[model samples]
Target: MLDLTAPSFMRAPHEQLVRALDRSCFAETRIILFGKVKLVLGHPEIQDMLKDGGRFAVDARNAGHASPFGMKFLPASLRVLSDNLLALDDPRHRELRHMVDGPFRRIQIEQLAPSIRETADQLVDDMIRDGENDIVAGLCRELPLQVIFDLLGFSDETRGKLHDVMKGVAGGGSAFDVVRAIFRLKPAQAALRREFENVRSHPRPGLVSELANAGGDGGQMSDDELLAMVFVLFVAGHETTSHLLSTATYTLLMQPGAAYQFRRLGREARLVAIDELLRYCSPVQMTKPRHARRDMEFHGQSLKEGERVMGLLAAGNLDSRVFRNPTQLDLARRPNRHLGWGGGPHMCLGLHLARTEVLEALSVLFDRFQELALDTAPDNLRWTKRTGLRGLKALPLRLQ
Candidate 1:
């Protein structure tokens, strides 16, 4: 059994376990995440399972079972988060995805390139003025949060409130901490509901306004679902991209050859480099748990209906059969079908925006500073303990 929740794996993922499972697509192995489940690490098999909505489902209801999470105990404010597109089955998921998909399309996101770069330059200027060194705190976290807040049309006050609320919510560790967090979140929850209503009557300039008015052929989402949708947007929109920025920058600092090649590439080639960077350090280590829709064998393994299986995306990225020299950071790697941003219907909606941010961020950064290097030793660098995401706690760099 692999305890992924352990501090060791959180600090830095070792590839030995993945190497051990190289002979098979998947093993009937025990792994603890939400609970014990079968783990898949092969690239082809995992990607296939992810794309096969008929065979596997994110919603347990589609598999004829109640949600395994004891979510009923949670307040409606919190419970509504589970009503997101990620938790829905076909038709509904497809519909919701299509409704919210307009703003995130590559063309729409590309229009924001100048503003994104402007924000990046401003952040860089702040870093230089303040003599800030921790890239995670100084640039990685702030840039994405600022961009998302701007995109959502959130006022500065709302951004501050939401920041505190999110910190309070995610900071909890024990039962006492959980109780404290719920109390802290109560006021913010009510305020956000009112904000959503305001968006309906008085339009805003961003995605929030469009989504607030959105009603596909299936009809409008309820207040709770709307809140959940926005919540998903706020969290997913910034969080994963921050990690991507942090880790990708760190990878570049670590590999000079890769960075050199990355710098020499054209715009299209640079985006490809970003794709390779995503695979090299998977922002999300694994896809959310998927359940079997029926009693069936998968890739030679037998199973029961509604059984849990986790796709180890990072390990899958390292599959030697799919990626040549899987461990090496090849900036020009072609046919990079790595599941870094995930794949299929549930693939990241903000991928275009994310790629834009990275491209502009790195371009402005390197173009500004001629010399950049890590301030702390690689061994001293820390990783976030939060499961499912891989990112640096800080990247202290000495730049000139």
Candidate 2:
């Protein structure tokens, strides 16, 4: 059995974990740190669970879920925070997804590429001015935050406050720290509610305004629901994309000739490369725990009703049954069915936007700074301790 929460497992190199899990028993069960929750490994089995929502549900409120990092939560605040699409079942999940789906469609996200490219160029320019810097802070972190703020039509003051709240939440420290961030989220939700109202009244040209005007699927969203959706997008859109940018950059830089090879590819080819990077990097390593709505037999294992199971997305991506040479980063890999963005109904809402940001960032970084290299030894670089999300804490680099 794989013990994901073990100190050795957490500290081991990421690739080592992927390879080990891929070769382990297909039905191997692992216990997570939180209340010893069960993790579901194996590519096909995970894919089936994600797609089979009737059997496995995303909403864990009734799964007797424990507080994150074993923290004690304020029930009221926790309830509000947990009301997003990720935790919703069908009907409501389908309704809200429909409302926002138009804004995140591929064509709509493509329309924002020029601006995304401009943002990337500006960040690269600043990096060039600073001879040596942490790419995580200077480039990866700021780009996604800027793009998401622009898309959401946030004011400077509101953006700063949201950033502080999310930064605290993303810090992912001890149980006390996690609980503190959960409490802090209430005020952030209030601030976001104000922004939503502003956009609703003024009718701006961005996603916030679109969401405010959205209805007809299941009537207008309640203020609480709106807050929950925005909260989910704020964290998902900002943190995940930022981590992808940093990790993809780190991965490419570490591999000899990978960066140059990626840059030389044509636009269509570059998009394909980004997909492969998403698969190989697997930034969001695991999905939120899904509960078995009823007792079910899966792959010779029995699960009782309300039992929680987490899909190890990273492990699935590296499964040899799906991708040949799964461990290698093949930029041109095709027909890649990786679950990096997840699978089924709860797949990432901002995937197109995330892809645009990462592609533009990579292109701009290499185009401008041809001699960019790591300032610190690869072993000295730090990885974030966050359990579900894989990302660098900092990546210092030498730009010439």
What are the TM-scores, per candidate, against the unseen true structure? 0.91, 0.91
Q: Relative to the unseen true structure, what is the C-alpha lDDT of residue 400 in candidate 1, on a scale of 0 to 100?
A: 71
Q: Give the Å error, residue 355, model 1.
A: 1.0
Query: lDDT score, residue 299, model 1?
Result: 87
Candidate 2 Cα deviation (angstroms), residue 85:
0.9
Candidate 1 lDDT tens digits, 278-377: 8988877778778898999998888688888878788888888888888788888998988888887899988999899988888876667657678988
The ten-residue window of minimal lDDT in model 2 covers 62-71
Q: Which stretches of candidate 1 lie over 4 Å from their true place?
A: 3-14, 27-33, 68-75, 167-183
- The per-residue C-alpha lDDT of model 2 at residue 3 equals 47
Clashing pairs in 1: none
Q: Global lDDT of each model?
A: 0.76, 0.77
TM-score of 2: 0.91
lDDT of 2 by residue, 1-400 (tens): 6544444444344566566665652434443244656666678888898999778877754444453222344457677766688888787789888888877899999999999999888877787786638878787878877888888777777888888877666543334565678777767777778887887778877777777777785788878888778778877877778888888988889878899898789888988998998888877878887888778897777888777778888788887888898878899999999898888999999999999999998888777778978888977866765666767778887776
Taking all chains together, the TM-score of candidate 1 against the true structure is: 0.91
Q: Which stretches of candidate 2 lie over 4 Å from their true place?
A: 1-15, 22-33, 61-75, 130-132, 171-178
Q: Taking the candidates one at a time, how many backbone clashes does each contain? A: 0, 0
lDDT, model 2: 0.77
